[model samples]
Target: MATPDAPPTPATHPSADDVPIDKSTPDAEPPPELPENARARRYVILSFWLVVVLLGLPLWWKTTSIYRAPLPLRDMQSWADGRACRAEFPLLVEVEAPELSDPEHLIKSAQHALDDANDFSAHHLRLRLASPKLTDSTGNNAEENVAATLKLLPGPARSSHSYQLSNVSREIELFYSPSYNPSSSASSASLSLFVANTLQEIFAEEQQMISHLLSTSTPAPSSASGDSTSGSSKVNHAEIARKMSRILRYSPTYHLTFSLFTGSGTPTSWEIEDAIDEYLQPLLGALSGISNFTIDSQIQFYASPSDNVVPEWQPDGEPAEGEPQRGKWVLKKQDLSSFINSAEWPLASITSYPTINFIIYVPADELTPLSISGSATNAFLLPQWGGVKILNLPVEKIDGERKTHLTREDLKSSLDTFAGQLMSLLGAPAHPSSLPIRLDSLTRQRSAELLTSASSTLGSLYRLTLALPSISIPTSVSTAVSSTLESLQNACQELKQGRVGGEGGALAEGRNAAAQAERAFFEKSMVGQVYFPEEHKVAVYLPLMGPVGVPLVMSAVKELANFIKGWKASRVAKA
Candidate 1:
């Protein structure tokens, strides 16, 4: 009984105090940390956050922020809106009448008549007397300041009054009857009126073109009386559109490609260099003031016409006795547009300048004497492209075999046609019969065109910047824009001063402005930021920042909550 009682003495569960504690083992929970240590831990975390906020954030921003240069947005917008510059063409016409004792009277009368007749104020024609010394020697104008020279001479007795414009120069000669006296007021008034009318006729097309350009570029205010000749009344919109469609856009330079496409390999080479020198050099020289030209030539053998140019077979008119029957090929006018086989031909431009292709296609012997239906000449013009001449070479017997080659003489007519087409494609006016006057008109037109083009580009760029706020604009773009604005200002000044053409003139300045504007608008760096937007950057950084930011944010929140609780507790105790 005593042994059983001793066995039952041990309890199943022992009390916490009854358990034996090991000195090597630590307690289940450590003692509460000292306030100094807790404060130190908070101080360390706060310091880390302060480093990230003050130093790390700024460093990251400095390294990653886009560099955007300040642009002259207002000035650009002003230029685009046509408020900055108003183009004016002040033409100077020189009077050279060596026979007249007092030229000033005639000039005054003519100027009065001109002022009264002219409806377009933007094109002011100022008349000035030529220097006696300069005109007395050669009767030629030595100065390039005048747009044209008006030459007055007394004709033979009983001869009728007539006027003729020099084809090679800017001189317009007026031959009056010997009976007509310059001293008589009636005769002087009549002569002055005639001169004014002639001048107006010479510049009518130019005024129309300028008016059209102004109206199209910026809507001009309509006159209350609607008597303004500068309105659409004078402009033939359909004709202008057709002409403009045929003309290539204004450029400082153009590349000319003269290609000879042959169905057979007989005509492998041609005297193109000589032909160009003789027929095209003069035109090119005259246009040098407006633009430069680069010319090249190539010959493609075994080249055939496109499918659109299906030729219809027609028997040759009454074949000679004992001669084999011959046939001719005819091309339809409707199919001329697709005659150029762009897919097979090498018509691609190699240079940066706009290319004008002049094609001379020669068919095989069987298809000789090819002609277009209902057309006199075998030539056609491609609007804004170039011209095509279907040259059919006569088959000649050489060493009892057929042979064909293009000589300078053979290419003369084609070259002449090409020259005329070139003038048309260059926006040259068909009036006055004076090459120099037409060239001057071209200069003014090109200047206006380039100025408007540059302004439009600047406007587009400004709009794009406003639309895309995140797009990066580099310093180069700002520099280009500044240069463009400066050049535009200079061009406007030149135009105002009547220096619209020639070296370092309004045209040149406008070209520079347009180039700079294009550079600014097409900056490659601008496209990069457009593709990589703010949302994309955030997405890229989310994985890395999530882990790091969560810990920092939670710690800050916990610390703030603890501070608020401690503050409340202290306030309660004090109350």
Candidate 2:
């Protein structure tokens, strides 16, 4: 649209207006250069910018925010409702009769006797008929080693008596009577009742244990297992709660550190190897399903405890050298949290594996009557950590009674205590007094607790994503959650259906559920994003945008005004 003869400046163009020459004309909105409605226009533009900065900016910020994954808040809360699973322990009772050709009848008779005598539904006995033709090799040597074994000899001089197994220490007894023969069809009262009653008496301790566990979680027999608890006995839920609180969350491999702390170097070594072989190894072997135990023992001497100079042993930081050393580094309740003496102690496990430490602190004779100042409580539990026991040993032993340094022999009693305590911390149920029975209770309890913990954790993960609005959600987390939920359902079903692990064949389903739940809760992708503050975001975005944006916006406004003016003039002409 160019013409060859046209001049570039329109102002220079001349028309037939030679007579009309105006010399005093002003342009560009007068000298001050103010446009029409300049103040109102400026205010309008300013108001628009203000709206964009305030309303629009914040809207964009919020709209493009991160996507947080959904969580199952209600499900999580329900899991924590403390009604998830009530641990029920039923003891496995084995009754054997070597003389009887048909042991099945005796087993049935004994079971009947036990059922009649039992009042607690949760802690009843399941009798196993000893195979009349037992393959001697199949008998658990571990069991045989810890209990008394009886030899059944057929005779008219009939009397049943239990005898210690010279080799295996199995709890087996011999019964005799020439005229007594029970038929396979018989399911009635006879000498079997006597035997059953005797068996019950032997396992009285086990019954009390089941009662204890039941009382902790749910409805109880009021009195069962002859535990010295009365029929009107109320559940010590708090005590049970304490037990649950103290127990270590379930782990497949439980590291048991047996540490021997002494103030002096006198008892540096112990016959622990032999004692473990004889007394402890078999019990641990029996608990294969409940847990895999790794034991490491250390004998520490001259191990000085931190002290406070004050006679009351109140804490006051480091004691000044000559000022009565006020409290002599006395430990307080708060101090237990960091009191592991990690620097000096051989704190790490030998295998470099994940472990739960069980500490035994034997203070020096110089620091007698040691306890946490003010807390007044001697033994205390550290959450998710390990347990501690402080033993006060006599300075010397006069006769067979202990009076001196802790010999390998004296350690037997202490190790026994520690071992027992370890089982408890491991959440082993107290019941049926039978070692087998106890082991079985521990297995079930662990499965139940693990199941709950994992499910609860999964539920937590479900809720967390919902609470934090600006978090990135990945498919891995979803997959993990799904897998864990599936596994938990399987485990809970197994528990309800009574298909969970039994003695050698521990509940595989429940274990899987627990493992899956833990995996889900600890999923790596869930915690990948770190939170950035809002101010930091503003700082990052404002630098480049503020300067560059101003000119671009002004240019847009001018172009828009010119287009509007031309369009309005065209419309007016048409009107």
Candidate 3:
């Protein structure tokens, strides 16, 4: 039998092609006929597809859609378009002189003089006259933002001159010779000429500043490309942008931090309160027109550069020469911005209240000579933020205090330096010469900048809404956007009418706009929608799909073949 089986394999060794093809019958078993209710398979598939498309789609959309507030997009776009608001700083400057042939004519002469001398269009200084015999209600209102006052004193003397700001409330005192009065036109006097020129000169810086802001913020005409005016503006911008960037955008409340850090422990507690009052508060009060300021002071101990530094000399000078060298530690210039030992220092204290923490870092005593790592640029500004100063505290055990914490007396000089740095960082405009005028300029700039930034953010949000299909928006975002737009409008109105104050109204508006913009753009729900994908849904349902598909497909095939065969049979019978 074994020989027979072997012989059978030898007999034919049928090739794969030689095996009979099972065409008529299925390999294992034939399919049963369609059940009477087989059409139920189609109903099942239809139900699943309907659920996925209708109920499932609605549920997914309900769960995933982001809350978008109905922002007045047209209004916002108009604001961005420079159409919603026209910022005109109508400065009401009153020029007064009790003695004159005709008060109105005298006023006319000064007004003409002002118009002649003025160049910057936006910051036009207009003149109003105060009655010589004035009372508390009408006597110039010195509290208001008066650029300057020209008083014609009955000087049995010669010419015109500015009185020392410490003595007089008036800015200029003109000594008229009586012959200095004009008859017909009411135009006469070298004193008047001097007053005109002097007044113009006083506001020159302010004028340029306002112009700089206008040109930068205003949108250029669509076809106004390659124009000399446009090119000239950009050239001016290159210079102006530097100064503007240095200045902080207006904040309603600025946190003034005075920190004393030295490489060693000699000076610990600084005369921060006394020194601030002496050198900083007056300036801060003047700046109140642009923003309110909160004063804070702190001291850090055992702070040093995280990395080792090796100094290199440049053509200019040595690398980090002063106090950076501590405990054989030397850092390069590149590492200076991050030089603060944030891990150890108590830089973060107040939980909120828009606190700007200005850190004063004094390295440990072991590394005595501290210096920046590279070529000298000892102090650098972190934009819209605080500053850093490296003060070398001399090693001394003073008043039973063993370590190098700054003392009030020891910090006198350091506080002065900090005061100077603080003013610079706050972006007080160089011109308008007076602290008050500079602060006003800062206010206007902040309002405009904040409005522009916030408007741009809204535009971006609108674009993002169009772009991100899966992202969900919440109602808070819309509410914030609305609030921002309202704040921007209100601030714009304040600035245009010269309602700007050292109290910082415009600056406050700008701050609100900026804060709101940040909130709107960075709503937590707007980002991070990466949990599920369409292909994944397809994958999860595939198991059910495979099983459900078999019956429906078989039913369809059998139905189609039967229909065709029945039609053919009917045709044959008719023939």
Candidate 4:
């Protein structure tokens, strides 16, 4: 009864009115007081920056920087500018005249005349008389060293003095009249004047070639392109450029391939061995001083032109009448480049030297003598490759048809053409006409070219290093560069001294330097260094750094903002 009565009272207690609402606003509490060591927060920010600048920056630089060898940049530039050395070719002319009474005096007079006649001092010619004993001992070797051997033969019946150069040897047979007798005078010999003029004429071409080479190699303007009237020696720049474009670069050895490509299966063999030994060996021997030659011949039967052969514009008998010419097939100028299918061609040898292809194409039936596009040439030369000769059956055929086999005598003309082509491709000068003299010119020219090329390569390498600072360089590259520079210096010094003597002189030094420089410039390790950009590096490092870098940056920025706020508050308090 009592509990029921209490529950009834509790329910009626709050029903009459609600509790009163509070109307007064409470005062805003002040921000919590700043920490005592709050100002020291700047130290943490400074420490982060210090670590990034001093340690992190250095670590990144050490990891990314490239290795560049210390090169003699000044020396390389001087060499490229042709200031390190002035090239000079000093030719030694040892006169061997057993017929003369006083050979020394005559040679001296001739030398003086030659000096007066020549205005080019860089190409200096010195004359010396060979002793009787030396001449006998230096039989074949004497011709190798000397420019020419003058064999003075007195022809009493001859009205005037005449000289003839031996094609096989460097011998000049001077048939003089009775008037040009050097034995008659000791001081002034009339024969000396004749000999001097003759010698000048013989050496004029060589002098021109040397002058051209020197001018081209150095910074000096080429005499070939200058006024011919201004200089005593003149060279044709256009002709030289054309000839050089056709000639192959200098090599220590050459692989000469003599290939007989015939459409007919009948002519399966040839006497190529005897033909080469008889016609080409002597020339190769003459050129042995400058370069070595390894020759091989092959006979390929059932051979035909490539499928890409472009027919002649108009057949011989067509004359624009649209009538087909019978039994006439030829290669046009445009077809010359594709004539030799290099993909199917056999290698001459497994050697470092370049292979020169010399082909003699024999047709199955009597085809008209093949001619080049622009001219009616029986033989054509392919620039930097080789030469080609079309062999047509002789008018008087064997048994009413073409011969089955070719003998040495039958292939004489074609072989001669190949020899001439080989000489031309070897950069032998046409002037002076003498094979020996031309070979000498080739040697000097090749030496000059090598020196210039080596110096240029050194300069290029130095510039490349400076341009690409991020490219990694290996120790092998550095070693090769050092070797190249040393060899180049040696070559320059030898050139300055004019040491163009019997081998091991400026010429040989230049060749060595060129080889070394080429090797250094074309180093595989040096070329393999790929460049990576800053963006690429950042992308690679982003994942590793994102988690750490964002928090550090945000903390630093928040600390900076708090410091600014505290500084402003402190200033307000002071005011």
Measured against the true structure, the TM-scores of the candidates, in listed sequence, are 0.86, 0.57, 0.68, 0.77
Question: Which pairs in model 1 have colliding backbones?
Answer: none
lDDT of 2: 0.56
lDDT digits (tens) for residues 1-575 of candidate 2: 88688666656656668567566875545454355665566667667777778897899879866654554556445544434443334444445565667767666776788777766554455766544454254243323111222344564464443322222323445454554666523323555676667656655544444455444432211222353233213345556666667677666777767676666664556666677776678778877766687877777777754442222444456767766443332555666766666677776765644576666677665554466655433444565566666665654545754344455575565556655666777776554344654564565556555554565565566566666556666656556655655665566555443444643232555566556656656666556543554567689778867885685589558857865987899999999
Error of 1 at 226 (Å): 11
Looking at model 4, residue 86 earns an lDDT score of 57
Residue 392, candidate 4: how far off, in angstroms?
2.2
- Report the C-alpha lDDT of model 4 over 1-575, residue by residue, as the tens digit: 36544444434555425866465867779887567556466677678878988999899889867776666678777776666665566666667766667778878888888777777766667777655654543233433355566777776674677888876556677777766655566324567777778877777766665565565653421222223213334567666667778889888889998899887675777999998889878888888877888878888877767779755533555344675454356667788777775656563466667989899988666444555666444778999989988887654567776678888987898888988898889877776666767776777777777777788787777777777777777777677767766766676566555454346766687777788878877877677654555477688889977986897799888987887998999999999
Model 1 vs. true fold: TM: 0.86
**Model 3, range 372-482, lDDT digits (tens) per residue?**
555253444555566675554555646766553345565555555565566677665555445545555556556656666676676677667666655667788878888
lDDT of each: 0.83, 0.56, 0.59, 0.71
Backbone clash pairs in model 1 (N, Cα, C under 3 Å; residues 3+ apart or in different chains), count = 0
lDDT winner between candidates 3 and 4 = 4
Rank order (by lDDT, best first): 1, 4, 3, 2
Candidate 1's C-alpha runs over 4 A off are 1-37, 99-103, 134-144, 156-160, 177-188, 218-232, 314-327, 396-399, 530-534, 573-575
Expressed as tens digits, the lDDT of each residue in 86-163 for candidate 1 is: 677788888888788887998899999988876666666898888766553334445545678788888778986678
In the order shown, the candidates' Cα RMSDs to the true structure are: 5.2, 13.3, 9.3, 6.1
For all candidates, the clash counts are 0, 37, 43, 0
Q: In terms of lDDT, which candidate is strongest?
A: 1
Scored against the true structure, residue 246 in model 1 reaches a CA lDDT of 91
